[model samples]
Target: MLRPIRALAAAAAALALVCACNSASGGSLPGKPGDAAATRGVSAGSIKVGGIVSMTSASGYSKKDTDLGARARYLRANAEGGINGRTIDYIGAEDDGQDPGKNLAAARKLVQQDKVFAVAPMSSVTFSGADFLEQEKVPTFGWGTLPSFCGPQYIYGFNGCLVPSPGGTLNQTWPEGIGQVLGGAKGKSVAIIANDSDAGKFGIRTFRQGFAGAGFEVAYAKASVPATAVPSDWSAYVKDILASDGGEAPDAVVSVMQTPNNIGLFTALKRAGYRGLLSDPTDYDPALLAKDTTRQALDGVHVLLQFEPFESANPRMDQFKADIKAASGGREVPLNMHMLTGYMSADLFVSIALKAGKDLTVAHFQNAARSFSDTGTLVGDRAEPKGQKESFGCGALVRLKDGAYEVSVPFKCYEPVPFK
Candidate 1:
């Protein structure tokens, strides 16, 4: 969950970032004049950058929050005059609650009607229209942590970072997250569950590998959960989970489910009196627990977070904290790494655009965003370069501690068993 103090602190930092907010907006960034939406070789006047996040509905709220956070940060950038004298005239939209049909339509509208220079980082690509923008070569960005989508087809993902060398997960969240609740999994039997969708399958597979790689026994791994129809019936699926005993009682259940079914999963687990570690890839927020009547049910479960808790003093996220607060009109926001990831994605692409100069094109962004260096871009999780050596590595495994999900791991650097 996003903390209020951090949001307040970030708002305070935005005031300081005003000067460095967009120093490049002085007509210098590549996607500026002749680069943006210029047709027939003519330059677009005010460089428009388009984006889509999953902000509404039960399905894609996290993705919308990603869009929301990105927009908020970009709004702060725009207020400071944008990149290179051209404010990032952003036209932000959402997939509308994980509706693939809606995202398909949103993609068409962004490219056709909006005519943006480039579309940027988004998550949970509605399995419905995963190829629209990719086939268009529109220079898109994504955080498709679910490995199946990480194939060469998507072309753009994980802030342009690929599948972290096969076994290495860009989000490597499952075992690491469950590690917080179950500690060392040497003798533990783990059960993995998720929807039959590609994302679910891939997440379970990668997590299984992470667990096995760390010497844990994967007691059960299943992703054949039936989606039933359009809007999935999660209650039925949870019943399936509860019914699947007879074998050795698992010590943990790793799930890669999306928002549409998470609440049901939690409810069923609680009712069955399963007192083991329940974990999910840090995709959606567990805040849904608070919103739903199942708040008390998710008592001891842990949620994996791919990035640093926003409040960490890594110097990388300090400025964003201030900017997001000011952009949200001082309303202490609630979120995890989505907003931070979105902010860095946009900022990193802008850096690439600046580097690409007047030669700015979709190809340039793909090339530049792919080559991010540590000192150059400090986003949520660290992807250090040769010499710099990251001060930290991803977020400390997080959990539902004292009514709020706070950092349970000690310092940084992926400690499987977080000693208090």
Candidate 2:
């Protein structure tokens, strides 16, 4: 009885499809290869693309301008006759709010409903949709700070993977640049702090090895800070960090967190009379200088950057500035690293898609990706598949002083140290 009922249902569905096809004057069915090709986000004149970004979050961190950066790159590409004469139909971006569930939902909406051919500028603290995007064979590009970017065939990081598992090499820019700032790693002590999240824990693990490998004494490393809420009181954290060197403050304190958390902690440290060197990966934005308190708190602080700073004299950097200004309607907005993140992500996608030739398809894109290599890019020399497991090993350090930024360490590539 069950088998008969199932067969009847299947027959009914087939009949409905045939009737629909007949209604369309004997047109082909939707699941055919020709239909699939036509239905994809590509056409003879354009390629549809979209983006996912953590534009807003509970902690007040926003990557909203990443959309603008991507738009700037896309606009430039389109102005220059597009990729193989097909203008990119960039659909802007989806705000994920940094929520994992929302991230997945946004990705699904883009693929299932929007039918975008690819995703670029996927700037988010969480990438819960990585697995779904991979299974669906959707090409994704973003800043590769999470483990999800590693070993995924369909996902790419614009600057290569920042986080890698054992047997992979770690970018030594952070530790090595810090070592250079302090004159030497020998006889120096450091404390590393991060939020109590997967990213944070992994950051602690990676940097612990990096600093130790650079000959710095890893006096303290902890990921006990809150991931979502910014703690108002930093006394307890300060106490632990101050005594991390067995009774005295470490020579340097490093934070692997965003600006809000950094401001609170660094302000607290100053209040607690910690005069040692301070550093973090974020907080290089010039807009922070608008407030006196923010400037004072970050005064003399060194920041780790994985690309050439906005102050670079490189011709490409000048072009980036011009493109951004044009994208913003001639309004000069204060630049941040997030902009570069988006620009580079889109730039990488465009570069590969162009190489895939005029008749673009997912298959062609992946084939091109396998051999993608470019030097003198804004981030660094890029190559595919290898980037899934390793970094491009390029970065620099900048220091803030009296409301200005100057390169403490020049932008350059360094050999990576193996992750133990």
Candidate 3:
């Protein structure tokens, strides 16, 4: 049965979503709220869950879904009975922002210092600290779709949606989609521009392989710049696009760069007056189109799909959305895939943790996670005509419509695109 969703204002909702997860569990567990050795209780005890997010970077401020949203949803979980009587204690979080090394340090601090039972919401740094998590037996989980990191005992990732994310279990969806685009487009040209970072390299290589398999010839592909690299004039970048190496000019340019650079690359494309279809993953926010005076510049540009949009037929998603909106003070809470990923991450983590039972050690949490599926989550319910397994339940491809995404197919799920 659906719980009563009390409507509140955005301020109230923010507060509600950010309540202290580690308070005196079931009366008093002692020490500053998040002491990992929280007292065991009959009905309630604090289950410390650590978080790492990009709080200090551009993505942190601009993206609605960040580590804060993950923590916020866990707070919401705590209000919902503390996950089988274990109140979540989001003891603390560190700001990795966009740095991979920082992510590793934060994860270490959370596990070694905070004594958290589990990590959630795709801490992003898990890839950096995968060894520590597996060695320590700390279960690291997330709504991330990247699959390469989803291995050993230390890592567990949620596909989040049928569509692939920049870094999640389904990161390979771009390559698969490119296959479809190229296989059908006859001899259409394709190009790629991703940073030189671990994720950037992975995204570029994976798609390059997939596109090649699908018989699409690459016109030109280059590592644009790393995330840490400061922005530059980018005139050379534009020249590179027009000069398609040895291959023919592409029918489209696929950029694997993050948002700020994405804007830059597109701006340069327009300045060069080159008219070709541009492609990007779903990482780019539709809202950015609002502020960009270069709106006319992106006409007919395409983006990859991670999952069908939430507005698609999904009773569970619709209800949770309403509940979230009500919790956010009656105003339509910003219900994008990012926030939904946070919610889904929170929900799945809770399910697996409690399913591990009161004897809950990190090992049990890990075991519970491997056996779990999206059978009861909002994403599962929202998916219609389910057919795919590794895919986020079942949903069709999506395209940016009216600056927002809309589903192009209802449940035409292909296999999980291989990013590994």
**TM-score, every prediction:** 0.74, 0.91, 0.74
Q: Give the Å error, residue 237, model 1.
A: 5.6
As a TM-score, model 2 comes out at 0.91
RMSD per model, one decimal: 11.3, 8.9, 10.7
Model 3 residue 115 lDDT score: 64
Clashes of 2: 0
Candidate 2 — which residues are off by over 4 angstroms? 1-36
Please name the candidate that would achieve the greatest lDDT relative to the true structure.
Answer: 2
- What lDDT tens digits, residue by residue, belong to model 2 across residues 291-348? 9999999998999999999989989999999999999999999999989989999999
lDDT of each: 0.53, 0.85, 0.54
Question: In model 3, where is the ten-residue run with the lowest total lDDT?
Answer: 1-10
Which candidate, 2 or 3, would have the higher TM-score against the true structure? 2
- Give the winner by lDDT: 2 or 3: 2
Clash numbers, per candidate: 16, 0, 17
Worst 10-residue stretch by lDDT in candidate 2?
20-29
Those runs of model 3 whose alpha carbons end farther than 4 Å from true positions after fitting are 1-44, 58-64, 123-127, 143-148, 160-172, 175-185, 245-248, 282-286, 294-299, 326-330, 376-398, 401-404, 408-412, 416-420
**What's model 3's overall lDDT?**
0.54
Candidate 3 lDDT over 323-346, as tens digits, reads 566546566745555565555566
